[model samples]
Target: MTDSGERNTMTRRTVIGAGIGAGIGGAAALTAAGFEPAPAFAGGSGKTVRLTVMGTTDLHGNVFNWDYFKNAEYDDSAHNDIGLAKISTLVSAVRDRIAADRHAPRPLMLDAGDTIQGTPLAYYYAKIEPITGGHTHPMAAAMNRIGYDAAALGNHEFNYGLDILRKFQRQLRFPLLGANAQDWTTGLPAFPPYVLKRVHVPGEKPITVGILGLTNPGIAIWDKANVENKLKFGGIVELARQWVPKVRAAGADLVIASVHSGMDLSSSYGDALPYPENASVLMAETVPGIDAVLVGHAHLEIPERLVTNKTSGEQVVLSEPLKWGMRLSLFDLDLQKVRGQWKVVARHSQVLNANTVDADRDVVALLQKDHDKVVQYVNSKIGTCTEAMSAATAPWEDTAALDFVNFVQADAVSKALAGTPQASLPVLAIAAPFNRDAAIPAGDVSVRDVAGLYVFDNTLLAVTMTGTQVKEYLEFSAQYFKQISGTGPFPSDQVTNAPTSTAPNGTPDYNYDIVGGLTKPLTYKIDIAKAPGARITDLAYGGTPVAADQQFVVAVNNHRQSGGGNFPHIKTAPVVYNRQVEIRQLMIDYVTTTGTVDPKTFHTTDWSLTSNGTPITVTT
Candidate 1:
């Protein structure tokens, strides 16, 4: 490999010919094969230039084969074949191709975070057997084997406390870069904001690739308690503005934003309006020095390279590999020097499916070892269920599995609070239907099923809220559903019309749905901006009118209890009871303790909407 300063002198023709020959099997054939060869422009005279970037995001602990929870073998038609083993194969193949082309640019492999905490393995690690000498995170182990260049922290990284997060960073083989995350008290970066590396391209000058990482500011709202003491996450755009120039000053010729955010362009107002789903696009447009963006979270698959600035129209590539190790994103970029500056002349992005490629043996072996250990730890049968508890349907409506989960959670909270001074107070439990659309079918309960039911391992918390607070909370939760125009099946428009918003400008009212334990014939309309205490109406607890001073015990996940999900009354509610119990454990305990659970017990007592002066027939 030549030194960085000597790179410009390299002969472009020799490099191009050699690269074409090795990568395409024929220099003349590839040109004839319709491959758009890089153009020899301005200062890029005889310099050979080739660079390849491979990325994956939102892996969600799918290091092994698909449906591991179901124990089903790989089947293409069933969407069954996706794993790190397969991803490793593609990585090796790309590396070999780059090697064969003596003139191609060096390759870099990266992950956009959200790697280890979404699957059964993560659940077992966090809730069952904690790794890292009780600090080690299994996701770090999995990522180490995959050989990431650098990783940007996703919001889920903060799901656990600072200790666990720090351990994960310490355990990683590569640096965790996040420009926006800072120590809450000092307002200084908690980790390095970016990393600059010299990549040696065969037959050309070493290219300085500057990689900057940023995550969504949503961490404050989603993980308030866990991150409250340790760190404060800043806005992505502000951080980008602050760091883009610094990265350039640090001698980075090409800047890539490894953002744990997303991009969306569907707006009534042209690209100027902020697209909640596609924050990456806005970041790219606002940050002048950024050349490309690799995004995650929101688990989307957007392969196209978008151009936001129509005037200069510089290309800004945005990509997110399909979650669960289902796909790999490859960014093939052609870099050329123009007046002492490098510009991306052309680029292409593609998703690699496991079924389409063979697995890399080395990567496979590494992941298999971890996979085996996790399987052994979670394989033991805890108990059996007479009826299959499933959450297969959307959680908003009644499903056997969700109903059972709410019932178990509520019962556990009530029992835990029963010995307190306020034990006899009416107890209300709230749970978000995470397994919407029955991802776990109604059947025998297994460790995998349990993991899927409550993947986050949130603790159970009980607080005291008044009848008025209870009614408002239910209305907020009801916002998850839209008033369908005639209910003709699931309306496509319902998604945009969702009653609740998770955006920065969203309404302040809490939207958590309350399950059972309430005897009020409460009625209320949703007024998003009404004062917290004023939205609820005709509220009563048990058979009596709720006294403004009378407090009622409410069961909620630790997230809500600590104001993580934006529930208003929860943050102020006195903790009647707090259990260091995992949501999954509560479900399992409920099943084992009761021997059998029925769906009828999980009925909703908190939601009702008025339409045309009369209550509309609500199903959930």
Candidate 2:
């Protein structure tokens, strides 16, 4: 977090004046030319001042309204449109509305992190045509055009290493804030913790708005490969407690937190880390002086939530826009001048639909060339498939498509550990159903086809675990299915994606992984009739019962290896190999070099669900 180079260039906060007499008094002159002043405040003005703060989070490098994997305009079952272009239009509308109102202060725009890594556009700049050499990142260009006030750092920002992230930060017009991201060596904040902006009032003191940024602590595990010895993360609540009072003491009348954590208090890493993965609600409940929070990273669309702080007895509002720029969060605060100072009297929050507006022409035009280049890159031919494979049935059935993923991962790991000390151990790989609609059609294939199958930007790692630990992992995965007895045939929806403690709505598809063997298929049956942890039956490798002490090298993604999904034993297990190889790129390379994806070479029906020993057939 302590990058001396960045500290030299970026201003942590704009310290205008601690009191009304410093800058806004004695004269009637504006703060600067071309800056219009708000309504004048007198000794007893008794005016209600309105201020609007707009926010977007988890943008994930999207600029245009397009999906690179689908090679088409982005659309889902909800008919939601994504990317900054749509958000730009929505923001403009909000700003124009505020500008037309004479009682409103200047509208503020902000983002809650996860900006520089998601789509092919983000990937292209990070890896292929890196922005490290001063080439403008599409996200920075588009966000700069949109004019953000500040943005919190997301865990994914470190995926491509600090070099790329530093360059991306330098390209942005606003400060990229991360109060919890600290220096590993010094244990001090590496990024600016907060920024204070002045909201001018014509005759009275300007409203000092303090914006604090906080990121998830899971970065210590998820991005361990990139940040191991360089940066460490502190809990959001702890950091907020230490910083909020300082912001208030610095003369902030209103404080807003742009937090890159979810409103939910769940942790994918479970008790592996002291801090929870999603702790915005906890922070709100624990921290004082925060009027509102812009939440992110959970990817859940929350319109508005009010949590009472423990000490202050004040209500703090929180709102999160859905991921990929699907929505915009808006907060309205009404301030009234007291005896001698302006104080916030009322506040309300809601989300504006980005799908309601067309993509802003200005934002699209600014990054259209970058978007087109990514489209071309993903559409380029890679190889051919002998037969089509789909992941639609992957959640209910052991589809060949997932097997192909496991094969590539295990094969790559096997080769990397060939001459190493762990070469003697067998290799197994785990894959999740990331995108249900992903498919690889027969005939010639493109990079998009393979990339679609593995949508996450996860890198590969190999960890050593016992056969017993593998079964424990599979048992945890089997919890994705609901317990049901005597089923001749059941609808896929009746069993899969069941609600769990960590995921109250339901376990995400990405949490249920399929473990496959390299030299031999790792076979197992998930007996849904049994209770959660006791569900796995007849677990074996190469048709033989896996012994309790059998040690094997498991090929896993960095997310899982670094404690994502709360899988058992992997986080504490000994790492056998880690080259920081991206799994998606590895699959693409496999297809490009082999020229053909013949599932017959790797696919096998290795796992299924059963009801009291009878194979349960699932109808999709």
Candidate 3:
């Protein structure tokens, strides 16, 4: 729990604040509620049963403590330790402590979804190895090895289509729970809504804990092609409202919600809509009878926190473990038999860092075959780069790194649209630098280098947009910088292009799109002096003033075209060309077939910044 903050306890009367818990042992340490810390069994004699629940979420198919991107040991230099292998060792040590206490119940482990689709290993199995041909998913094998009890469905679960997801479900020993992912035809839960577990605590009576799984409603938007009309998802709060009472009525002593959503207190897309991506905070605040909530999808590590139920004013403990096996959320509930009923008297929640332990030998042995194959596959030489390319300057200025992707995308889509009616229109490509660590490293350009640069499962989409729409899209990307007024060609750091590091800062580099296909510069002076949308001016296309109705084909990713980032008119942009082949592969093919990548040939120099009337110097 000390990872982000100290462990917090939720009580009936009031939730105590910070200074009181960290041992200040004075009048200054008195809580806002003016209550001193007291032991659970301070009043009368009662049997105390302590059960620890551990959770992992957004693991995203990391099984080893090795960075598949770098082809090296996963270290602190990258600011990440992403793998279930290390988590396995950490879990074993914690379980050993529980085993020493004969009276303690078997500790329960849970996952909140996004178990697949991040690394080369997961991509190898899902796309290359073909687990659909009847092999156990590597993630499934690892989770089963670690002994997970249940997991929720995340929006990314539908990324590979339902059959593969169903195959994963078949391979898992534990149930895949999704209360809101329903059968549209039957209007019933397609997957098990919740799983009930009764744990025997040595001499005390068994306690039944119900786990409810809720997925993000964004599935319908993000994966509309795969899930359209087949499966419908409801909001987590609405679904929990219906199912929490049902689980309690089913003789459950406690209810724990495993929500695959972030803590967006205010629902995006307005109050009337069902928010899928983030609604964990609203769910925990509104839903009653829930003891602790395990949340994910935001990839934030909150050691421990307390939220008050808006309607009933009941305090609920909520914790989010950062994504990719970096941390584990632990909820330890102290339940005592009060009046013949097992009820929670005190609860504590904290996220444990997975870096504390070495990679589990069992996990390493289990995945060694696939690991070795992926290492060789990524290490295989694809082509060569004439000069090194780095995404280091992508945010501050349009660099060759992002230009490389834009050129490949525009060229591929232009070829794909050869026979189509939209082929005559000029094709403009929009791309972003997703990985700041991505670099060409000089000589050979391997699969890992290109894959590391793109670092997403996004495919290509060629959408028809007018010149006006193009400007709006650029304006959206322009929001990455803060509005400025002074004409002093200020420090580049003064601009608000905050990169996503340990936490989300400013506009994430992945979401910041730069435009291509113009003889004119894609960059322009932001007269921070003007309004946000109105700031973009002097827009030209091909040595001429851009007309409002001027039309062109724009290459984009499916995520953005599906309203992922709320780019202006992007979701509504008509698709002229679409392909399922990943853009990362296209980058590799572009380089492999084209011989060598030269910065002088493809690097975009078509961008500059100006403040007021004077030219400005911005860091690249």
Best by lDDT: 2
Error of 2 at 286 (Å): 1.7
In model 1, where do residues sit more than 4 Å from their true spots? Answer: 1-48, 73-80, 134-138, 265-278, 309-313, 383-402, 408-446, 449-620
Instruction: Go through the candidates in order and give each one's C-alpha lDDT.
Output: 0.61, 0.83, 0.75
* Candidate 2 structure quality by residue, lDDT tens digits, 309-418: 99888888899988888888888777887776667666777787765555566676677667667777788777899999999999988998999999999999898787
Higher TM-score: candidate 1 or 3? 3
lDDT of 3 at 506: 61
* C-alpha lDDT of candidate 3 relative to the true structure: 0.75
Number of clashes recorded per candidate: 19, 2, 1
lDDT of 3 at 559: 79
Between 1 and 2, whose TM-score is larger?
2
- Candidate 3 versus the native: TM-score? 0.72
Per-model TM-score, in order, reads: 0.64, 0.74, 0.72
| Model 2 clashing residue pairs (backbone) | 1-190, 2-190
Root-mean-square deviation of every model:
12.6, 11.1, 10.1
lDDT string for model 1 (1-620, tens) is 11111221122111101111112222332232233433443344634365778888877666655344444333455443566755665566667666877777768988887665665566556656665455445467656776778989887777666666777788888989899899989999898899997888655567898899888676664565687787887778788889989999998988888888877533111222232323677888767777778888756777656655443457677777767676677777778876756667666666655544444445544455455555554444555554555554333334455555666666776666556687777766666656543343344445665666665547676777876666656655555444533323333333212533474344222244535553332223433223333334445545455666666677778767656867567777766555345677667545545654444455443433333333334332
Name the 10 consecutive residues with the lowest summed lDDT in model 1.
13-22
Please give the RMSD of candidate 2 to the true structure.
Answer: 11.1
Residue pair clashes in candidate 3: 217-276
User: Any idea what lDDT model 1 has?
Assistant: 0.61
